[model samples]
Target: MIVVTTPTGRIGRHVLGHVLDGAEKVRVIVRDPERLPAPVRERVDVVRGSHDDPGVVAEALAGAGSVFWLIPPNPRAQSVQDHVIDFVRPLCTAIGDHGVERVVAVSTLGRGITRNAGLVSATYAMDDLIESTGVHYRSLCPPAFMENLLSQVETIRSRGTFFAPISADRRFLTCAVRDIAATAAALLLDGSWTGQDSVPIVGPDLLSYEEMAQIMTEVLQRPVRFQQISGEAFTAALRRAGVSEAWAGGGAAIMAATDRGTYVAEAGSPGPTAPTSFRQWCEEVLEPAVG
Candidate 1:
């Protein structure tokens, strides 16, 4: 059986869909069964509860051989690291208890950097904790998500301006979540690979927020601009928007590390697992969202 956590989430939903296309038995751990699409609800075994709960995880993992693990984003969590640990600890215990053979998890880049990159560091910690259990694991490491720009769709449409905490010219790879899901689903279905590895889902372009804005301008036929904000300002904005202090600080850290060139694609690493380009993403995703 293949068990998927966060099956209704932005990335998870896509992962679930791709996995369901295969012939394997699929089960989902979700907080609310109603959130699942009607057709999807008809197909999989639904264990209705947060994956963060031990009982719920154990219940879902019973007779399951492979697991798709994703920590649902929690902007109001008191502590980012602790929030990740809360979910991962149960799964680690369950992996040992259930003898689950494989784990495919969504993690971020910046695996070995010395500086503290809040959410990135949290994901690294999660990798370590899960690896300690010795389950065959694949960490899907993608850089900044292109869909993150969708959050500024309103501002981009109304004011032709979007904001970021990084420098305007800082080049970094950005990935599409669909690409991440494709990689996860392929791994889940084949189940031929072994012990542990990090799958880098990098997009084709190495771009800056400024280049992205330019692409938006050409694609959307308007003058969209990139506005750079300080990390402090970024965190303060998140706080003002009701995100908890810890999560907001983590956001700042991610941006800070990005600006410091922490997420640059390394030499001779595998080619872009996430093949979506910035222009393609703008034309396909951002343009539709703007409309």
Candidate 2:
């Protein structure tokens, strides 16, 4: 059986769908079973609780061979590092106790660049903790999510503008969540690969926010613009939106690292590059969200 965590989340739901289509016996650990579609609940073994709980994870991993892991964000958590550790420790223990063979997890790019990055650094730490367990692991590393723009959909619709902490001309890789999920599902369904490695799920396009604005303008047929803001201002905006101080500060650190080009793929890097271009993502995903 293949166990899936966060089965109703944006990327997890897609991963679960693909796994089911591959005819894998699936089990899901979820906090609220009702949140899942009725058909999904009927299809998988439902362990109704947070995966961070030892009992919950132990129950979910019983007789499971492979797993899809993702840590859901907690905006109100006191510290980002502590929050990540709380979730990872239990899984590390359960992986050994249950004798699971392979694991696939959602992680960020930039492994060797620096450690001062908030979420990026924390996720890299997670990779290490899981690897220390000596199980077969694949870290699905991707840059910024294009769906992050959905947070500003209302602003784009009303003001024809979106804001970011990066420079207007600073280009970076961004991947669609669907592509990330597709890669994860493929790894989970196949049992051939072994050992540990990181897969960079980079999009085919390297785009700046200004260029993204141009594409949005054409795709949405609106006069959209990109407004560059200071990292402090971006953090403050997140704080005002009611996230904890640590969460807000982490957001700033991520943008600061992005501005430093931490997510840029290395020259001739191996592994699969995602095929979704920015223009195609805009036309298909962003335009629909804006509408």
Candidate 3:
């Protein structure tokens, strides 16, 4: 049996689809079962509750051979690291108690760096908490998600400009969520039971925001330009979007770190080959959003 958390999300849904083919039993933990896609909700056992609920997590992990674990960022968290550790520690304990053998956690690149990375700090905490359980674990660490660009689609469509704090020409590694999900599914199904491992899933090539804008413009048949915003401007924009001051500040700091190469991913790590290119992702996913 395999259990997946956050299964309604982009990466989790893909991983669930990939693993459902041959698995005798598959389960998904969701806050609200009714919100899941009809097909997915029907095919898998649904554990209704958040990952913070120990009883729910234990039930989800019961008799499960493998678990795909991911914690969505909470902008409202008092202390992001504490909130993450609070959830992960008990959940890992529950999974262990339930005799779950393997855990595949979704983390991010640049997680080990001690300073200048805000959210990555929390992910590093999660990795450590999961490792202490002594369960066979694999941490899927990918660079910036290409799907994050989707949030700027409206700006591209209406203003013909996509804005970010990073330098438009500074190259950074980027990976598609689908690629991350596929790699994670492979790890779960392979049953290697590697004790503790961190895998960096990089893209075929490094790209800058300007390069990404070019590809997106070509795919959508619109003139799109990358505009570099000041960290202050970025933070204000996030604040206007209803993000809390603390989270907005943290987000701006992370973007600034990326601009300075502090968040740059290391050159190589052992993981699956890049599955999709920026052009491919834009053509297959981004173009449809414009329509």
Shift of residue 108 alpha carbon in model 1, Å:
1.0
What is the per-residue lDDT of model 2 for residues 1-291, given as tens digits with 9 covering 90 to 100? Answer: 999999999999999999998777999999999999999888999999998899999999989999999999999998999999888998999999999999999998888775788977999989999999999999999999999999999999999999999999998889999999999999999989999999989898878999999989999998999999998889889988999999888888999999998866567554338988889999898988889
Which residue ranges in model 2 land beyond 4 Å of their true spot?
266-272
**lDDT, candidates in the order shown:** 0.90, 0.92, 0.82
Per-residue lDDT for 1-291 in model 1, tens only?
Answer: 999988989899999999999999999998889999999999999999999999999999989999999999899999999999999999999999999999999998768763688888999999999999999999998988998888888999999999989999998878999999999999999878899988888888888888888889999999999999888889998999999999999989888888888767668544576778889888898898999
Q: Estimate each model's TM-score.
A: 0.98, 0.98, 0.94
Ranking by lDDT: 2, 1, 3
Per-residue lDDT of model 3, residues 1-291, tens digit only: 888888889899899888887655888899989878797777999999998788889888888999899887777666666767877976788866888888998987776554656676677889988888888989888877889888987887789898898998898878899999998888888776667888888777678999988888888888888999898999898889888777787788778767877545455433335778889989998888766
lDDT of 3 at 120: 69
Q: Give the Cα error of residue 20 in candidate 1, in Å.
A: 0.7
Best by lDDT: 2
